[model samples]
Target: MALVAQFLVADRVAVAFAKREMASQIRSGALADLPCDTPPPTVSDVSIGGFPFLTQVLTGSFSDVGMTMTGLPTTGPRIERISAHVRGVHVPIFRLATGGDGTIRIDDMRAAVHMTYADLNAFLRTQPGRVHITPVDGGRRLEITATANLPLLGDQQVGGVTTFAVHDNKVTLVPSEISLSGLFNLTLPLGNLGSYVPQIPIPVGDLPFKLTVTNASTDATGLSLAATATNIEVSTADQKPCRPTGS
Candidate 1:
C-alpha cells in the first residue's frame, strides 16, 4: 500500500510540473505575440483536463486544456476576462519532461471575452464625442446616448435603443429607435440623425491564440465576444507565433 501511495504522489507531481511547463510556454510565446501596442495579458488557472495525465503524456495527446486570462488590452475597450479551451493538444511527453523544442498542435479551440459596462462607458467617454450605455429590458437591449457637437448647436444629446450585431470582426451597435431629449422628448427618423449620433463599433479581432470572432452578445455585466479557431500549430519557443496548421 505504501508503494502504491508513493506512485500516486509522484504521478500528481508530474502532472503539476507538466501543466506549469505548458503554461510557461504559453506565457512566453502566445502572450508575447500579442500586438506590441498593448501590454501582454496575464494568464491564470491553467489546467490539463482528463484523468491519468500520465497516459496522456505517453500518447502525446491531451484531451483538453483550458486557461483564463485577464486585462487583455485592445484597440478599443479593454477585455476584462478571456477564457479559452483547447481540444486535441499534441505535444510530446519527453519534450515536456526535458523542456526541449518541438511544435505543439491543437485541433481546435474556443474562447470567450468579456467587458464590463463601466469599462465600455469609460472607453466611450475617451472618444471624440460623448456617449454612454444603459441596459434595458434586463440587458437584452441597450440604451445608447451620444452628445454630438454640431457646428452651431453646441452640444446635442440624442439617445436610442440598440441591439448587438457582429460584423467584420466588430460588435456593432445597431440602434432601432432614435429620440431627441429635452424638457419634452421627441422621436426622430433614424436617417435624419446621421452624423448627429455616433455609431459605435467595439473591435474584437486580433486577440491572442489565433482565434477569430464568431459572435457577440450583451448581458447585465457587459459585452461578450465568442471566438473560435481550428488547426493551430505553434512552436515550443516562447516568443514564436501560432499559425494555422500549414502556415
Candidate 2:
C-alpha cells in the first residue's frame, strides 16, 4: 500500500510540472492577452500514460503525458477542453524535484481542443445580420436561419443546413440546404446567398513551438481540434526573471 501511495503522489507531482510548463509557455505565447483580465489557465486534469511513475523517473524518460487545460482562450472561441498526448518526454524529474533546473523535451505530441457552439456563434455573429446559426438535426447540423427583405417577396425568413469540414487547419462551413421556403411562390432577389461559404480561420495555426493542426471535427459540444508538434524543447535556461536587469 505504501508503494501505491508513492506512485499516486509522484503522478500528481509530475502532472503539476507539466501544467506549470504549459502555463508558462501560453502566457508568453501570442494569445496571452486573448481574454483580458481573466484568470490564468490551469491544468484541469492529467494522466501519466506509463505505469509506476518511479520506473519512468529512473529511466529519465516517459512514454506519454496527457493534459487537460482550462481558461485558455482563442480569438474566436473559448477553449473548453484541451487534451494533449505527449510521447517521449525527456526531462530530469529528479533534479527538478530537488529544486534544480533542466530542459524538458518531447519527441512528438498530439493535442485535441474542444470549443463550445456558443463561442463559435460569437465569431459567426460578425457576418451579415441576415445570417444566424441555431442548433438543429440533433445538433449534428447547424440550422442557418436568414431574414431578408426582397423586392416582390417582401420580408422572408429562410433556413438552410450547413456542412462543416476541416481544411488547411481551419473550419470550413458550406451551406447545403438553401432555398426560399415560404417565398417560393413569389420572385425574390436573394441572389446566391446560399453559395456563401464561411471559413473560420483558427488561430491554432500560429501556435507556439511550431505546433500544426492536423484535423478538426464538430460535435454536440463544439469543434474539436487535433494538432501535432515535433521536437519540442522547453528549457529552464531560457527563463526570464520577474524583472529585467534595468528595471
Candidate 3:
C-alpha cells in the first residue's frame, strides 16, 4: 500500500509538468503571431513658388560610369500623422529634399529628407490613424492604402493616392506614376521622356526602403531608410541600426 501511493504521486507530478510545458509552447506561438507595428514619418508642408527645376550629370566612363539626375519638390504631403495598428504605435513624419530652391534638380539631387527612429516613435505615439499587420507564409506584411486632398503648385488642388507594402521590415511605395513634364524636363535621352520633354514621376517604385526593430516593447533599437534603386543592397558599411530614441 505504501509503494502504490508513492507511485501514484509521482505519476501526477509528471503529468502536471507536461501540461505546463505544453501551455508554454502554445503561448510562445501566439506571441510570434502578433503583427509588427510602426508609424510612417511626417513630411514637410511647403509650396514651390516657382517653376520646378531639372538637370542631369554623367560621371565615370564606359568601364565605370555613373549618372545622376535631380529636381523634385519636397513640399506637400507633410506627414501630419502616422499610426501602426499592430503594436498601437504612432510616429511623426519628417521631410528632406535633395535640391535647393525647394525643387529637386537633377544636377545636385541627393537625399534631402530623413526621419530618425526617435522621431518615428514619437509620431507613432501621437498618430490618430492605425496600422494593421497580417502574418503571411514567409513573414509578416503591412498594407497601407489611402487618399487625401492636397494643394498642387501652391494654389491648385489635386487628389493624391498613396499606397505601400511592408514585408520583412522592407517598405515599398506602390503609387501610380505621375507625369514629370509639368514640373521639369529631362535633358538626357532616357527612354520614354526624350521626345516629350522628359518628365519623371515620384519614382516610388525605384526607391527601396527597409526597417529593423529590436526590443520593440521599449522601442530600443531600429534602423530604416528610403533609398534609391542604385543604392539598395546589403553591405557592411551601409548597414545602419537606428534606435527608437532618434539617435
Candidate 4:
C-alpha cells in the first residue's frame, strides 16, 4: 500500500512537470510566425488528456492536449480567446520532464478564435460612423447602429441587420437592411445604400500554430473562427535544461 501511494504521488508530479514543459513549448513556438511587436497572447488552462499518464510517458505519445490562449492580436480586430486542441503529440518523456532537448511532433491541431462584441466595438470606433454591433437571433444576426452624416439629413442614427460570413481569411459583415431613425423612419435596401454603409472586415490570417481559417460562427458570447492544421513540429532543442526539483 505504501509503494502504491508513492507511485501515485510520483505520477502526479510527473504529469505536472510534463504540463509545465508543454506550456513553455507552446508559448515559445505557437506564435513564432507573428511579428515581433505583437503582444504575446496569454497561454493558460493547459491540460493533458488521458488516464494513467505514466503509460503515455512510457509510450512517448500524448493522445490529446488542450489549451486556451487569450488576447491574440490580429491585423484587424483582436482575438478575445483561442481554444486549441492538439492530438497525437509525440515527445521524449525524459526531455519533457527535465526540459531537455527533444523534438515535438503534433499529428493535428484544431483551434477556435473568438472575438467579443466589445473588441468589435473597439474596431468599429475607428471606422467612418463609429458603428456598434449587437448580436440578435442568439448572435446569428447582427444589429449595427451608427451615426451617419448625410447630404440633406446631416447626422442621423442609422441601423442595419447584418450576417457575418468568412471570406479570404476575414470575417465580412454582410448587411441585409438599413434603416434611418428620424422624425419619419426610412428603410433602405442594400443596393440603394451601396457604400453608404461600410462592410466591416476583420482579418484573421495571423492565427498562431500555422492554423488556417476554415469556417466561422457566432453565439451569445461572440464570433468564433475555426481553424485546423496537421503534421506540425516544434523543437525544444533551444530550450535551456531545467533542473529537477529536489525532494
Candidate 5:
C-alpha cells in the first residue's frame, strides 16, 4: 500500500499549498488573476489527522512564488483616510475682491495635507516613495511635494506629485507624480492664509477701526470718507481730503 499512501499524501499536500498561495495573493491584492481552474493550493489539512509527509509536500510547493506570476488577480489600491497640517513661512501677499457697494471680501487661503497610517501603508505598497501636488491659483500656479516612510510594510520611503490651477473661488487639484512600485500615493494637501494677509488697525479720531489689507487688491487700498458738520459747509476744493487747511 506504499503507492496508495504516497498518492494520498501528495494530494493533501497539494491542497494545502494551494490554500496558502491563495491567502498570500488575496492579502497582496492579486488573487483574482490566479487561474480559475487551479484550485487554491493547501497544506496539511488540519481537518484531517496529522500527516507530516503531506505537510512537507504542501510547504515545498510554494517555495519559489513570485509577485508577477500569471493567473493571479490584482486589486486596486485603497485609501482609508487622510489628514493634513499647514505652517506658513514667508507667504506672499494676496488680494481680496470688492463689491459694488464698496465692501471688501477676503478669501485667499493655504494649508497642508497629511495621511492616516492605514492609508499611508496601502499607498506605499503600490506607489513610489515621493509625490508632488499642484494646487489651484486664479491665473497662478502652485505645487507641493510630499515624502515619508512607507507604513505597515517597511521603513522604506514613498511619495507623489500633483499640479493644479486656481480660479475665481475654486482650487483645482492635479496629480503629477505616480510611482509604479507602490499601490498608491498617501500624501494629503494642506494650506495657510494668514501668511498672505496683513492686519493693520486704523484709529479714526476716537473710533478704532481695523483694516485687513491684502496687497494688490483694489479694495484693500480703498477707503470711503463722509463728514457732517453743524452750520459749517464741508466741501473740499480738491477731491482729496484737505489736510485741515492751515488755520
Candidate 6:
C-alpha cells in the first residue's frame, strides 16, 4: 500500500510540476492562443500508472499519466480529464528541476479526459435548478433533474432520463425521458411548452489534449466521460515564475 501510494504521489508530482510551470508561462502570455478563459487554470488531481516512478523517469518513458483541471473558462463546456498514455517522454531531471530549457516528445501518445455533471453546471452560464446529473438503472439510464416553470402550471418539477453522446470533439446531452412532476398532482395536456426549454448549444467543456471522446457513464456523483489522443508534444524548460502581465 505504501509503495502504491508513493507511485501515485510521484505521478501527482509530475503533473503538478508541469501545471505549475505552464501556469506561470500562460499568466505571462508566453504561450498564446491556448484554451482556457484565463491563464493558470487549477490542477485538481493527477495520477500516473505503471508505477515505480524513478524507473520510468530513468527509462526515458512513462507508461501513463492523467490529470484533472478546473476553471477552464472556455466559451463551450470544458472537460477536465487530462490523461495520457505517453511514450518517449524524455526529460533530463537535473535540468528540468532547475528550470532549464528542455523539450520532450511522445513517440506515441493517447491523452484522455472526462467530466461530471457538476462540471457541466460549472460551465453553464445559467443552469436551471442548479441541474444535477446522476446515473441510475444499472448505468443503463441517466437522470437529469432541474427546475422548470410552465404557464398556468405554476412551478413544475423537472426530471429526466437523458443519455449523452460524444462526437466531433463534443458531448451532447440528449433527453430520453424528461419527466415533469410536482404539479400538485395536476395533469394538463401541455403541448410545445416542454419543447420551449431554455436549452442552449453550449459546448459545456473544453479539453487541452487532441483526444476523441470514447465512453461516458453516470455514477453517484454525476455524468462521467473519457477521451484519448496520440503523439502529443510538450516542453518542460519553458517554466518560469508566474507573474501577471504588467504586474
lDDT for each residue of candidate 6 in 60-111, tens digit (9 for 90 to 100): 4556644455555456556544444444445454455465656555455454
- Choose the strongest candidate by lDDT: 4
Off by over 4 Å in 5: 1-145, 148-151, 154-156, 165-168, 180-247
Candidate 3 structure, TM-score to reference = 0.17
Off by over 4 Å in 3: 1-20, 26-152, 155-162, 166-168, 177-247
lDDT of 1 by residue, 1-247 (tens): 9987887887798688768766665555456456434445677898998977777766878899998888665778878988889898887657755857787788998998888999888888886557788997767888988875544657777787766778766677666667778744878767755566666777666677677887888888888889988898776655544565665
Ranking according to TM-score, highest score first: 1, 4, 2, 6, 3, 5
Candidate number of the best TM-score: 1
How far is 197's C-alpha from truth in model 6 (Å)? Answer: 4.2
**Model 4 per-residue lDDT tens digits across residues 43-153:** 899999998887786778889999998866677787788899999988776766674677778899999888888888888788777788898888977898987666577
> What is the TM-score of candidate 2?
0.69
* Model 2 spans with C-alpha error above 4 angstroms: 1-39, 94-101, 146-157, 181-202, 207-209, 237-247
Estimate, for each residue in 1-247, the C-alpha lDDT of model 5 and write its tens digit: 9999888878776655544533332222211223323332221212222345344333332222211122211232221111111111110111101111111111221211112223323433344433332333431333333343323544333333433223332223333432323455444332232121111122222100111112111111121112111111111111122244463
Q: Each model's TM-score, in the order given?
A: 0.83, 0.69, 0.17, 0.81, 0.15, 0.57
Question: For each candidate, what is the lDDT?
Answer: 0.75, 0.61, 0.24, 0.78, 0.27, 0.53
TM-score of 6: 0.57
Writing each residue's lDDT as its tens digit, candidate 2 over 123-185 gives 666754346667765567677766545446556666666656666666665556655667374
Model 3 RMSD vs true structure: 24.6
Worst 10 residues of 1 by lDDT: 31-40
Q: State how far residue 7 of model 5 sits from its true place (Å).
A: 99
C-alpha lDDT (0 to 100) for residue 111 of candidate 6: 47
What is the Cα root-mean-square deviation between model 4 and the actual structure?
5.6
Error of 4 at 91 (Å): 3.2
How accurate locally is residue 70 in candidate 3, as Cα lDDT from 0 to 100? 21
